[model samples]
Target: MKKFWNWKNQAQTENSPAERTLFLNGTIAEESWFDDDVTPQLFKDELNAGEGDITVWINSPGGDCVAAAQIYNMLSNYKGKVTVKIDGIAASAASVIAMAGKEVLMSPVSMLMIHNPMTIAMGDHAEMQKAIDMLAEVKESIINAYVLKTGLSRAKLSHLMDSETWMNANKAVELGFADGTLTRDNGGAENSNMEDAVEAVMFSSRAVNNALQNKISAKYGKQKQTVVQQSEIPAPETNERNVDALLERLDIIKNHI
Candidate 1:
């Protein structure tokens, strides 16, 4: 089985802080960590192998919520400060892991998304109902982590999740999902800033839908205008003759009546 995380030790320098860099680059766990005893233990051992702060770089579309929850618990319980930096996108289960960071920073171009928990069940009506209940409980559990970090109301968070909200760096900071935005310094080093130069910007499925609608309207609008212009043009001489013939027939019929 493949592991989902990589660890790198960075030497303490006078100009920078000493920290271990952990990269979570793909799916949370390609294979279930709970299935075997060895992998989880190995992950814990490596995490505890060093001292000082930890810098976690996350870039994942997310997978295996349970595995992500376990990772979150481990990072939250660590002795050193945990700082999470999103270099790409963190969606679904990966977003839960991001909540474990004491200070979460996002790249200016990175994205974060949150949505309701989902599962597949194969069984009768009772089993389906059970799955539904289980998913609701799981959603609540995930919300606990977000609430702790963002201090946002549960109702608001739930609505966001229901809508599958996506947020950019500034929007994440504004919503308290992130503490700030991460940028490169003059020394070609990464730096986190609380005050991003750009204002908070929100990106959602609704906005995408609206833009698509606008494009469709613009595309069809021209065609509709062309049809209207053609309709307004005077009728063909053949059509005029046909109309005159009909009018003469009507007059003859009236005279006979």
Candidate 2:
């Protein structure tokens, strides 16, 4: 767990009337970026702040992939609904973080870019091959996240990533990268269906749910394992039923349009 910025301290010293208490902002490319100790703490504090939706403000050029992944997981597994707002740009690993949000909201001028994972490696031909294989595996994992969030075809998503696609707010929403654009006038009504999808996804994969639990326990340094019992797991049939119901709802909405 990393806490890169002391957002609370900054807020106290430089209070802004327009700032929401739950809004968090950080730059991934700046020096001292991705401070492991500070970023996680801020996220924890916000998560524990009571029962309500959270808005995460991102304006990053992207940095440490591991750190970004951890933070993204934390937000995704949180009990409350999480909305991500890309205020400026979310590139590379930052794009992964954006996908973790329950409902992604972007400013009209915001941008998002995604590309294949990259890493520096020093090794022989065999070792280099291994590195390449690992990178491919990692890319698949990242692509799964995007597919789960957007319900987009894997082939299309892979093509976009390969092209290092850059998306504007309208394009993002059209492509399912974002739920919608945010208005300066007010924070609009939260979407109940989006909230349900977030909760459903948390319970959909046993591995993901377990990983999240382990991360939380490690964060608190608790020896006790928080195991989700088999009976608690959502059945595959139930998931299919939910999806069918969602599709029906969408069809009804379309009829009204």
Candidate 3:
């Protein structure tokens, strides 16, 4: 619940458009082995606060997959057009979220990265195979988001993901990941063509695991009643392996939230 990506609305005048701003900075899920995260529920609440065109600012390393998926759906479902501006980098799950925007813009030196989904498992071959299948489907679902926005073919997107593609502002625009590079002046105002004010970066949870779980459930719901109950079969319990195993599972689970 308490992660860095706080959603806040800026004050607007009576005649100004009811523009809402979203800041996505940091990991996408709560328990990040690398850094902190931004949970999905809080994001949903922040996203629904206003009723006008929205702009999101993102700078993140990326985290949970399902959390990013749900956020993407929410933004795509919004009535108003959405614009995304990348300041630093939108890697992995963060890049997926960027695809939801109708117009995506990037700072001249900013970057975007995409790659395959990852998970950890300790079960026998059957369970391990299930994990692999789940990850593959996750990758496919991510590509769906990209294809919808960029009009890229499934084969090409898959290849890009496999390669862990990293693109710069111009390349992103050329590839359709971004509409254009943001044009600003010494006074920090957007060039004559840009009408909105630049949003400040806000340093941005555990809900990611929940979202990942939900995603897996939706795909494998037939297994929910059985698996959610019996999937906890004990692993060989020991001091070191137990800790490592739990951490790995957490690494994989937080994306659902």
The collision pairs in model 1 are: none
Best by TM-score: 1
Report the lDDT tens digits of candidate 2 across residue range 1-257.
33333332223223332233344345553443345566556656755654545567787777767666776787788776777878888778888888988889877667887878889899799999999998998889889878988899989988787766777777777778888775565555332223322221111233456577667646543322123243565434433333334556777999996
How far is each candidate from the true structure, as Cα RMSD in Å? 12.3, 21.9, 16.8
- Assess every candidate by TM-score: 0.75, 0.60, 0.68
Q: What are the Cα lDDT values of the candidates?
A: 0.85, 0.66, 0.75
Best candidate per lDDT, number? 1
Error of 2 at 75 (Å): 0.7
Error of 1 at 181 (Å): 0.7
- The TM-score of predicted model 1 comes to 0.75
- Candidate 1, residues 160-234, lDDT tens digits: the string is 998789988889988999988877888543556645366666656765776786676566656656876889975
The TM-score of candidate 2 is: 0.60
In model 2, what is the error at residue 179, expressed in angstroms?
A: 0.8
